[model samples]
Target: MSRRDFIYTLSATGAALSLGACSADGGSAIRFGYIADYNGASLLAIADKQGLWKKHDLTVEPKVFVNGPVQIQALGTGNLDYGYIGPGALWQPASGKATIVAINTLAYADRVIARPGINSMRDLKGKKVGVPEGTSGEMVLNLALQQAGMTMKDISKVAMDAPTIVSAFASGQIDGAGIWYPLIDTIKEKVPKMKEVASTEDMHDHIFPTVFVSAAKGKAERDRKVMKVLQEANDWRAAHPKESIALTAKLLKADEAKVAADAAHVKTMTTAELVAKTKDGTVDKWLDGMSDVFVRTGQLKKSPDPSTFYAGDLYTKAAAR
Candidate 1:
């Protein structure tokens, strides 16, 4: 079946199974899906390990996925009540299969790295560039190309996951890659000559927000409570940075120093700050920009209406609690 058809089927299946998806605690212990790439979802990992979810009267069943789009597909099929996803993989929102509830981390985590001798985006022409299709890596690469007066058509696109991309770059299978940390860090360590040609850090207006999303039936009052707990967890991290980094490194099975460095790339907001940002149109503006980038990259035929997918009211109500 076509991708769109598959997504439609998943949504229909989820709607049919919605009645049984919730648990006894008003759906507090909902199934959560996340990527294991050691990004902002580490906050969720911290919450799970630190008993923050339990503190908020919630139980969680954490599911790990290879990438955001796959996890989002599960979310559409009733396999997950909540998911932590990047904006580029949120095509489900355009189709009315899910709604973004809260922003987890906003930062400059995505990067485009070039193998030595190809130092600029313009030098990428005719070169093999690796990225996980339908993820933020691809989106960022497209933006980088646009900035250089080029497009995906200018390069030999290689679809691969971050770790595989690292291997490919090391083996000379691909000349460059657009990937996110801590995987980008891995590539840099493995290939000392790799040059970071572009990054979200250079695109200040183009923020990378790892957001929390829920299926239609998953957006219950209990789910809001869960988000509130996530806000509380962010507050805890801010107050206890050392402990948070140690715990995150343990959960990710990554180097403590690497985790600490990764932590610096992302900024988590408090409940009040989340509410204020969403209310002041900042979130909408960012979503609009994200949609444009997706469309420009041929990921979407046209941009979806930001209002349809963004549930700012969810964050507003969660913060009010």
Candidate 2:
């Protein structure tokens, strides 16, 4: 099935309700939210399938959402204890409603693809550019425009969800789009001429960190253990690369080679490394930059103090175990 079709199937079938059978030990259960994207949440799937959560005393019930905004809303309402989200989704709600506990991966996932004849970022001026408004797709586009000495006003902005943006791109409805995989990969397969003009790889410093977020109320002892075990799962993936790739590919129903290649682009950190980054101001610096982009995009009225949103103590404690 197509990426759009696959997402529709996930939504219509109530995929969240089928996150494996509930744990008989109700006290150990945790509601985990994640996007059904290959790049971001595949590790969570690997953990689930490999029984890592059980080892860590977490009976994780996976909740799948279509996009980051919806997942953030679930988190804000306390329906989810933990979720994976991009920096664009994290910054605004994280300022008050949620706390980011871990940076799961630094991924070169987002891409700016232009239709035929639009050769450069400058060529995108005066053309229609599609972006998923509230997610990292828009953030990356905004950053790219700023880097090109332009603004959103320089182009006609078309806001759509990632899948629809891919459809629009295929139909020649939008001149280009700022999107991530597997939509980008799907689009390229259908529209071979789609030119990739920019990506997160180009905006290295401005890139958004895909993170694990939780509401303040959910940060109990069990939730903290969940975070640590997630790091343990990441370490497991690194140590057992072949097995990791096989399981993730099977879960995502994607090709193992493609999954392996995509996985390579993501740098997963350990619990100790996470603590060090948090302490040395690296996380703060990245969030500060993202906050400025959020304000410029009108996603936030004012930038919140970037330091207030992190829960570094969780990782520090998790690492101790």
Candidate 2's residue-wise lDDT over 1-321, tens digit each?
A: 455543443344334334445553566467777776654566676677667776765576677776777777887777887788876676655557777777777767777889989988899999999988778788778888888999989999998888888789989999999887766777887788889888888775675678887874555676577777778877776677778778766655666776666666676666567678888888777777778777777777788776578776767777777
Candidate 1 lDDT over 246-287, as tens digits, reads 876555455678777777888766667777888898888778
What is the clash tally of candidate 1?
1
TM-score for predicted model 1 compared with the true structure: 0.87
lDDT of each: 0.72, 0.73
- Scored by lDDT, model 2 comes in at 0.73
Regions more than 4 Å wrong, model 1: 1-29
List TM-scores for all candidates, in order: 0.87, 0.89
